[model samples]
Target chain A: MDYFRQAWAIAWKDILSELRTRQMISSVLLFCLLVMVIFSFTFDPGAEYVSELVPGILWVAFCFAGTLGLERSWGAEQENRAVDGLLLSPMDRSAIFLGKALGNLVFMLAVELVTFPLAAVLFGVSFLDVWGKVALVAVLATAGFMAVGTLLSAITVNTKLREILLPILLFPILVPVILAAVKSTGSLLQGEGWEGISSWVKLLAAFDVIFITVAILTFEYVVEE
Target chain B: MEPSLRRNLLGLATFMMIEAAIFMIFIWAPTEQVMGIVQRIFYFHVSCGMTTFLAFFIVFLASILYLWKKDKKWDIVAHASAELGVLFCTLVLLSGPIWARPIWGTWWTWDARLTTSLVLWLIYVAYLMLRSASRGSERRTRFAAVFGIVGFVDVPLVYLSIHWWRTIHPVVIKPSGIGLAPPMLYTFLVSWAAITILYFYLLGLRIRIGKLSEGVEELKAIQYSGV
Candidate 1:
């Protein structure tokens, strides 16, 4: 109960702070839009190409844009040097990790929500048929991404070259998420349904569970002095 | 035994074994059924690939142990292992393409093994970059350890996801008999053993260099400030 409360408090802190500024969301949203617009121009693949490649394109956007959001997720705490204050509080450090990760997830999901609809418009595809499946993939993949992302963000946050450092550390470790999500989403977009993507879904789930648990357990060391 | 004597013996053993492996590969082993001479590269390529994985696994274990014990030696081992892993992974990636160009009729394909090995290489490169980017010794060591652990945990998942993602790709390796003739099998085993020894030989050199550099740094600190 106390852990939940503590985590919720930290998450709410991030949310309320973001609501005040809206900086992270707008930048990430715009970045996603720009990526979509740019990639759409590179190849005017017929309906076949779009179906085959849209998932990879969308994931690429999310990967690039998601980094922007994650980079700023801990920006406020870092800028204020409030991690020490949070660490000093009697609450478990894992709670803080959970709260921050939850908060990042919420922000990331919001970006994806808008990105999906906009991508549908920009690319001229019907997302209604597979929205649910796509959303499931998004949720799982994004959680896995931010699980390691948030942890690495905390590690890199104190560094001078954090912006470059985050993606280098995050992306290579994220190959599985990208592979599973893009593969699964590709099948979903092509109307293959859940039957086709079950294996990928399992991989995504395994990745999410393993990484989230690890990030929660090990995050204390990342923030300690 | 004295350190130098042990090192000399180890060096001699590694050199002789490597020479034997080469001789066995070219002179002793029968030509492979399908791929002919191109198949010969598979011996060292596959061994290096496996060695890279082994090296990174050492980094993983060292990372966990470092965090558990808060020891500097584990950090050094983790760093040394990552350095070697990256080198071996580079060879794996390079040799994959060279071998592929001849056998697979293409320089590269999105084959699962190749894709995952490239990712493995990138992850350890990130590990090295992370080590160099951070300044504080304690913070640097801790960050590298955590990243090392996380990167390793991703490795199996990387393999599984890539495996599931594709079915048409050629299977590059199998532990049990997909069928290698007796002499080919013996040469493969010998090459693997030689590479494994080479890994340890390089590891001892790398770790000692790391320690020597640290000692020099300490000496400089003592000279500059009143240690």
Candidate 2:
């Protein structure tokens, strides 16, 4: 119960920061929009092909943009030396992970909220049919990625080569999530029903569950001096 | 680092040669019923693939031990096993392509076994690269242990990849396919045992060398610092 309160407190802290400054959302949204535009120019294609590739393009944009936000999310904590303040608090350290993950997830979801509509307009696709499935993929992938990402971000914060090292360490470990997301989202966009995409959904869910448990158990170690 | 274990490793190498001779005779001395002399390559190829798997499994165990104990010695063993696993995996990959060139018509295909081996190679190569790029002993061990645990998750996935995807590798020796004849089975067992012994002997030597290198570095630091 206290963990939930702590998590929500941290989440609200991040949310309130974003509301005042709007830095995270704006940066992520701009990066995502730029990617979509670049992708549009890179590929000369019919509407059919564009729609087919849009799911992948959207996720790729989300992934790269999400990294930008995440790196900054912790950048401030490290710069301000506020992590020690948070760590000294009475909350479990894993609660900080959950809070940050939720914060990042909300920021990503907000960016996607804008990107989805633009993707529909830009790619000439019917969002009504695909939105729910896309959202499902987004939630699971975000949960899985941030679950590992937050812990890894915390771990990398103390390293000397952190700026370059996090992605190198994070990407290989996150391959399964990316592969599962791409496959499931591709299947859904291809008009495959839940029955076809169920396994991937399960895979994403399993990955989220496994890593969240691991991050919770291991977060204490990562933050310890 | 013990004198007797070093001697045991030399003896292990001798036995490996003997087993290699026996394996060769079994392949060459026997007349082919179906495939020609090319089929002989299968003995070394398949046995080496199994040996690679065994070495990686040792890596997994050693990694878990290292993490649990935070001992540098176990990290040395884990590092050694990963090196040997990559070595034998390379053998499996090279021999597989060679055996295929004569038999499977092409050098490579997207078969499950071959694809998974390629992925395994990529994963371990990345592992080695990550280890090389780290600065200190503790940092290297911690990062490698985490990667070792996560990277091994690919092994079971690779093993089951054939069921999940298409593969042209013969599954006959496996329960999923027809079993091999007794002589072929016996010869394979002999080679597997030989390779297993040789792997441990090599792993022990490598770990000993690594410890000695670390010791030399410590001595150099003391001499320079005059401490």
Candidate 3:
């Protein structure tokens, strides 16, 4: 209970700060919008094939924007040396990881909330009928992405390349998440129902569980002085 | 034994093994009725693949040890192993396409094994880049170790996801294990043994280079400190 409270407190700190400024969220949202616009230009928006392309475009937007936001996730901590202070406090390092990952998930979900509907509007493909299923896949896949992203964010924060190194280190490990998410989303958009996506859903869930557990175990080593 | 003498013996043994493997692969092994001469690439290609996995497994183990013990030696081993892993993985990637062009009729297909190997190659290549980008700090060592662990842990997941993804698409070639005849089997074993020794030899050489560079850095530090 105490651990959960501590983790929540850390997460709340990020939320409070973002609420005050709204810098990272706004930029990430704009980037997501831009991705959709650019991708739309590549294909005829009214073409029959547009539905098949919608899921891939939406995910590409989310991933690129998520990468942008995650790059900033650790920026403030590193700049202010706040991470060292957090380390000095009487909290478990794994708590810090959980808290940061939670904060990232919430921020990413906020961006996706707008990006999804806007994508549907711009691409002229309505997934409103299957909105629930799409959202579930989005959250599951994003959870897995954050689980790994937050840890890699921490690792890359210490590197000389900084933000440049995060995606290079991140995307390869993220192959499974991207594959499962895109495939499931593509199927869901086609109205294949749960039967079509069950295996992929299971893959996403397994990836989330495995990575979150691994990140928790390895987080301490990344943050140790 | 003296270090130089040991290295010489390793070199000699590796040389002999390579000679034997070449003879067995080209002469001793009978030509396949189907793949014919092109099948010969299979021995070296498979051997390189095995070595790549072994090298990565070493990187994973050494990385865990480095983090647990906080030893510089283990860090050096991990770094060296990752570099060698990338080398062997590149060989696998290169050889796959070369063999595939004539056999599979295309230079590349999204086959399960092929896709998995490509993902693995990208992951370790990133690992190498991370090491180079963050060169000197102890913090860099810890960061690399963390990635090393995460990258390795993701491999099975990558393979599983790609395998499923491939099944959904039309598979150009059904990936099946080749049943090697007796001579082909002996040839493969010898080639595999040769490549494994080559991996060890390169690992040792790279580790020594790593140690020497560390020594040079220490000497430079002492000179600057004017103690």
Number of the top DockQ candidate: 3
Clashing residue pairs, candidate 2? none
- Identify the runs in model 3 with alpha carbons over 4 angstroms from their true place: B167-178
RMSD of each: 1.6, 3.4, 2.3
Each prediction's DockQ?
A: 0.79, 0.26, 0.82
Q: How do the candidates score on chain B by TM-score?
A: 0.95, 0.89, 0.94
For model 3, which pairs clash? none
lDDT of 1 by residue, B85-187 (tens): 9999999888888878878789888877888888899999999999999978889999999999999999999888877766445554567654577787888
| lDDT, candidate 1, A140-221, per-residue tens | 9999898889999998877768899999999988888998888888888788977988888888899989999889878988
Model 1's CAPRI class? medium
Better of 1 and 2 by TM-score: 1
lDDT of 3 by residue, B1-227 (tens): 99989988998999999999999999989998987898898888889988999999999999999988989999999999999999998998998888888887999888888888889999998998888788566877888888899999899899899998874323322468446678898899999999999999889899999999999989999999998
lDDT of candidates 1 onward, in order: 0.87, 0.76, 0.89
Q: Ranking by TM-score, best first?
A: 1, 3, 2
Q: Write the per-residue lDDT of candidate 3 for residues A1-225, one digit (tens) a residue.
A: 899899898889999999999988988888888888898789876899988888888888888889888888888898779988889979899999999999999999999988888988887777789889989999999999999999999888777898889989899899999988889989987888999989888989999998999899999988876
Weakest lDDT window of 10 consecutive positions for candidate 2 chain A: A155-164
Clashes of each: 0, 0, 0
- In terms of TM-score, which candidate is stronger, 2 or 3? 3
